[model samples]
Target: MPAQPDYTRRYTVEEYFALEEASDIRHEYYHGEIFPLDGPDGPEAKAGGTKRHNRLVQNCVVALRLALRGKGCDIFSENVRLAINEADHYNYPDVVVTCSPADRQDPRIVRYPSVIVEVLSASTEAHDRGWKFQQYQALPSLQHYVLVSQRRRLIEWYSRSDSGTWILASVRELDEAVTLSALDISLPVADLYENVETGPEEGPVLLRLPD
Candidate 1:
């Protein structure tokens, strides 16, 4: 969701957690700032997932669920919070995968996701590519950060190398497949855009990542 700078009020991590529990809308907490992810303060409500966006997110769940079976890893989508570190960041990703036993025991959030997937929208595109990505990379367990275009047939896959360098790869064509070496599964671009329109108006051509 698009963040608003007008929100000047800051809350301690303790207060942020309490606010999240009491609030109806989901908000992303960064440091002491709270970025409301839904309602009037946010770019759009949590229920505002577009037809194509929601479809793509569900497709990711289907693909990940099948691929992760019997692997002892669990996949969570929407409404699940991912803590970047203990005291610094907490936000909800569209999809998150966690295999940590500690994460398995925690009911409030997952801290060690192996992968995070985001279905991009016009409002939240910049944050997803810029700040959000930077924070996700800080997680030691994160191996892949996947961005799926809701407006077009494109996927930007960012994988971390053994030396901690991030490698960027893009799959632009419908027939191309995005290989997640970490997960050992390749997702066909066509499969992600299946049943969804891909024309200029309906497609996500504007947010194509650089190769």
Candidate 2:
């Protein structure tokens, strides 16, 4: 196997945004290192599941779009890249809802996102719930962060209250419902996993291994 690329070089937030061609794949920059995202398999694959996870995300997006109809907010899927900070860390989330006008400048990437949703996968669950969560909190306009479980029909919502505290609200089973106050909408968990086939009821499983 070939040697992995070195990405320890530090970069300023400005320099990171100056890159002209930074698409085709996803990358995460930390401290000063840039790590290219791996292919969708293994941990990512498990999170994505066979077809259940895909439908869940899709259904959620559709519901959100309908809820925000006539509102200025635009809903985006995984293709849009989001610049988090310096070192040029850019990631593509499963769903992004942005009401900021700056989103029009670059249809392919968004700078300000009001809400970001990551479909929890075995490979990315930890970061989504931890480091990535920290980074997202830095955005002043961010009001909601959602994590959807792939193995089962569940949704965890983190909402930023008026006091700036992030409170956790959850929808445990498929029959339970969830509402995103940030977008002013509610959804049934069943819609999220319309065609999913879950195995035995497993206990709480952490999605990602520690870095």
Candidate 3:
């Protein structure tokens, strides 16, 4: 008989961080439920094409850093923590930009971010567009949420309007340029997917994160 795998029981936000191996995998705590973070599996999972996906994310990071020079806004990749609330939920997006001074000193976690970006993979597409989007919208300082696709060169920009509504804007194809009004910067889609290879029919698509 095969031995059964032992799953770690549910843990509170405080208990989740008390362990030494907490960094190994991302965990989400929702209403006292601790769930392992997982992306899509099967075909959607394979669509990522690791090298291409990673390159896309890296290119954006470099461009963003250069654009924000001397602006007092710090940008971070997935390793940085974003505390969603006091109870439990904490997340790490592909990129987070914070202009708030308080977040500058605390290198470990950021409470206020002006903009957040996620490079979409098949496995995480739904969550990113749905549940995760809801969580991010709750942050008072989150002015913009951007979703970049791995399959094709597409960008979706969600900006908060004066009416407290998030408006959707999209840029498709490598030739199109995208402007992030929140950051006061613009870039061509080609720069985002630089050095990435894709099939003729396989191009990135950007969609609104669900409300």
Candidate 4:
């Protein structure tokens, strides 16, 4: 195994931006710290998406595009940076939908996002559900946060209510659809898992006893 990479160093937002400009690796910045958004550290380490993860993300973006066409909304996938708060936090969501004119004009990080989607993996599921979602709650423009499962046909949906309460919803059945009242559109659950491969079985583990 390769030695673990170091990330204890802190950085200013300017420095983070400069690093991003100079390096090919993508990092998420939060409170003067950066976190890599790639696979595990080693020669075999690849980019951050499995076959299922990438397909689901692509399906989501395509669905949103059809629903929001000619509505002045833009959908970004994988590469665009989103500002959870201006300088304190930033992340690259799997899919981001923005209808704000200000966000459409911004060349760098998007300040206003209407919806954020994250395709869950073994490595990122906890962070996506915990601290990442917590930080995303602070964004005033965020109306919905969607989490799609990679190994199963399930989606965890969070939407803000009229009284500023966050409501939890789930779409687990193929016949069911996720009703996004914020976007005024319903995304069919089947569309997301269409013709995609998933559910890799775990292999048996063998224990080495006191060798």
Candidate 5:
């Protein structure tokens, strides 16, 4: 891994919050640095999402919406920001599910999300599976962290176990379903890829551990 820029000009959390409110584009704040989230720049811009990625997000939203109806959980997309902790880490997940009544108090940010989803692209996959995943684990309320691949028909489910360890499960079969134990709902893999072109499973399967 290469070294990241120092970002000499760091901003305070309050300053970053103000910048986020005034900017037209979205930005993610971590520690003391603010990074843009959109345009042909920034981390997510490296391997910009394809048409399939967008469709998958929509499918997930629809599936999760119907399944979670009247369950006292509100679903949000990338439009909403997630605050992982007090000092650092604020992100915009592709899909967010919050059930805590406390989260309703803040409209600008979600403090506690039961489930957070990220649609992976070639550029963002590494950060999603590595750094971002590590940081997201800090949230006590996050029971499920889902990663959907746009390159292939793959879904990586990270569920928090009773012992507080994150267990990884890979779902690849198109006919199979992804069970979100935290939400008590299952989403069919086929439905998520509806009308989307997911090429052959070329690369190694995600989180393929020994049986």
Candidate 6:
């Protein structure tokens, strides 16, 4: 979903909660600022994606949920808020998986997440790969972060190592799959784009951990 800065007054955590309670739209809160995720204030409503976008997201969520069923890990997609106190933020990830007992008890905010998947669009690409991913790294329980592309059948998989470093890898070919060692499962690049339509593919992406 597209996150646009709300130029209004800064809000406390309490006030932000109140705003969310009274409003039907979903907004992300960060450091007393509210970023509306939907509505006219937001040029393209991200909380709700295009039909093509929705299909991609559903494919990811359904696959993860089916794989983790009865294993105690819960899979959630869209609208579920993840609270990052380390960053003073509350934002909704497109897909979130958690096995934390503490998260199981909480209904509103997820403080711990094992895996996070985001289907990227032009507007959200930079933010998702930059600030949002940085904030997510603050969650100690997070082991894998996946970025699904709408322009092509690709997934960028970032996994944390035992030595506490993150390694960046990706699968963009149809027959390729990325293994999530922490989850003990492999997701095919083709599987994620199943039944989904996309625009023209972007130029090839070459990524490595920044120095």
Off by over 4 Å in 1: 1-7, 45-49, 199-211
lDDT of candidate 3 vs native?
0.73
What local lDDT does model 3 show for residue 19?
36
Give candidate 1's TM-score. 0.86
Per-residue lDDT over 94-168 for candidate 5, one digit per residue giving the tens place of the 0 to 100 score: 999999999899888999899999998766677788888888999999999999988888888899998999999
TM-score of each: 0.86, 0.79, 0.82, 0.87, 0.87, 0.87
Which regions in candidate 3 have their CA more than 4 angstroms from the true location? Answer: 1-8, 20-23, 38-48, 199-211
Query: Model 5, residue 95: what's the lDDT?
Result: 95
Best by lDDT: 5
Number of clashing residue pairs, candidate 2: 0
> Poorest 10 consecutive residues of model 1 by lDDT?
202-211
Top of the candidates by TM-score: 5
RMSD to the true structure for each prediction, in A, is 5.2, 4.0, 5.0, 6.1, 6.2, 5.3
Counting only residues 3 or more apart in sequence or on different chains, how many pairs clash (N, Cα, C under 3 Å) in candidate 3?
Answer: 6
Q: What digit string (tens of lDDT, one per residue) describes model 6 on residues 136-184?
A: 8988999999999887667898999999899999887879887889988
Q: Which lDDT tens digits does candidate 1 get at residues 45-90?
A: 3324467677888888887887778888889987988998779678
Error of 2 at 175 (Å): 4.3
* lDDT of residue 6 for candidate 1: 39
